[model samples]
Target: MTANTRAPQQERSRATQQRLLEATVECLVEFGWSGASTTVIAERAGVSRGAQLHHYPTRAALVLAAVEHLSERRAAEIRAEAAALTGDPEDRVEQVIDMLAAAFTGPLYVAALEVWVAARTDLDLKAALIPLEARVGREMHRLTVDLLGADETRPGVRESVQATLDLLRGLGVANLLSDDSHRREQLLAAWKRQLTTAIREP
Candidate 1:
């Protein structure tokens, strides 16, 4: 009897934590870091302030957890999209670039940017973010290499992969102010051609 009751309570706790983390991301997107206070996040999650603190004792903790949660979800989505690609090597490269560009301009990226900017001055947040960012970067780079079927042992192949990510990230930044989609599309097209050449082995 006690075991049955405990299992349900544990499940409910997990559900509530998930809601809080998700709400934190929404708050970051809508309000930016400064406005995404604990109260606002708790309210957004439809949970009490006490519950928010119980799950995440501080604003930085909450925001970081949210970013990490959303990042994982985004990575899974990218993986699924990658798995669905059926094409020639060059075609797959083009599709991967397009997929990455779309991801960089999405809401999760915006929330991450907010946290990144805030972390620039917040030592605690910066310390926490460093490892998470490194892990995410390595995962993205590895996935890109795998999807492109690139021979990293070949000269310039690894750098080309890194450059592709950097370019998409710059475009994502450009998109923050206005609709940079027109310019982004053109730039991506040109880069895709260059990337195709750069990643192709002799």
Candidate 2:
């Protein structure tokens, strides 16, 4: 087939995939994992059940693909913000902290939260999630270092950065159940002060 002939077909495929993945996230966020079944997802995406199965094969595959789709979007956003970093070291630190804080409070995180909860007892989902989550964790660690301008060679700097992520994840969990913007802001401010103090002693 000519390139022109294939272009529309490829574009249509991509659009269909995106719609299915988005519907998956919405279902997971709105109805939990069991509710986000392949049939419902296909219905929500306005695609046929056969099309959804052709792409995902199973519910676990569908959910994981949706997670991967969300991950790429976030990674792109973080890289853009990292590139735009400016100001004094303290400013960079605070800005990055706020960026990280914003990451945990959104719809994407809520969708991910449901997936994690459902994965607890679902062996197939757990198997897929473990490897994908590992890959994402590594990428996030890299982004954290990039955002922090941290000398990973320096003692404890890497661990401190990891601690920042750990703390944020905890706060993200807390925010799921409570209005934690005020608490998160307070903790983020304290973390920034502590990070500044720790990294300034070069």
User: Which candidate achieves the best TM-score against the true structure?
Assistant: 1
For model 1, the superposed segments whose C-alpha errors exceed 4 Å read none
Query: Distance (Å) between predicted and true CA of 157, model 1?
Result: 0.8
What is each predicted model's overall lDDT from 0 to 1? 0.90, 0.86
Q: Global CA lDDT of candidate 1, please?
A: 0.90
Clashes per candidate, residues 3 or more apart or on different chains: 0, 0
RMSD of candidates 1 onward, in order = 1.2, 1.6
Per-residue lDDT for 1-202 in model 2, tens only? 9999899999998999999999998888787767878888899999998888888888888899999988788788877877888868889989988888788777777888788888989998998899999998888888988787888888888888899988988888999877899978887888999987776667
lDDT, model 2, position 69: 89
